[model samples]
Target: MIKLYIKQAFYQLRENRLISLVSIIGTALAICMIMVIVLVLEVRITDCVPEVNR
Candidate 1:
């Protein structure tokens, strides 16, 4: 069940604190990097034209 899987993950994270911290930070950094890239692409495509607004 999902509960068991979550409990197992919690225990694993608790047992290896350093590894868990590193893994969590890495995942967060990767997600943030992806979001920044997506935002940059959106801005570049939407706001790059000068004559569109004026």
Candidate 2:
């Protein structure tokens, strides 16, 4: 059952290569944006803290 589902998914992905590519790119961009935001916030927070706390 799982194998059949996997096969179907693969076929669908192959059939809609452009769509799959777009989806992958969109997901990657979203992940990158979130990571950048988190890193920026972390840096700002650490910078605001006193050096004595480090």
Residues 1-54, candidate 2, lDDT per residue (tens digit)?
999999998998999999988998999999999999999998887766468665
* Cα-based lDDT at residue 5, candidate 1: 100
Candidate 1 to truth, TM:
0.84
Error of 1 at 30 (Å): 0.3
**Which candidate tops TM-score?**
1
For candidate 2, the TM-score is 0.74
How many clashes does each candidate structure show, in the order listed? 0, 0
Q: What RMSD value applies to candidate 1?
A: 2.3
lDDT of each: 0.94, 0.92
Backbone clashes, candidate 1: 0
Estimate TM-scores for all models. 0.84, 0.74
Candidate 2 clashing pairs?
none
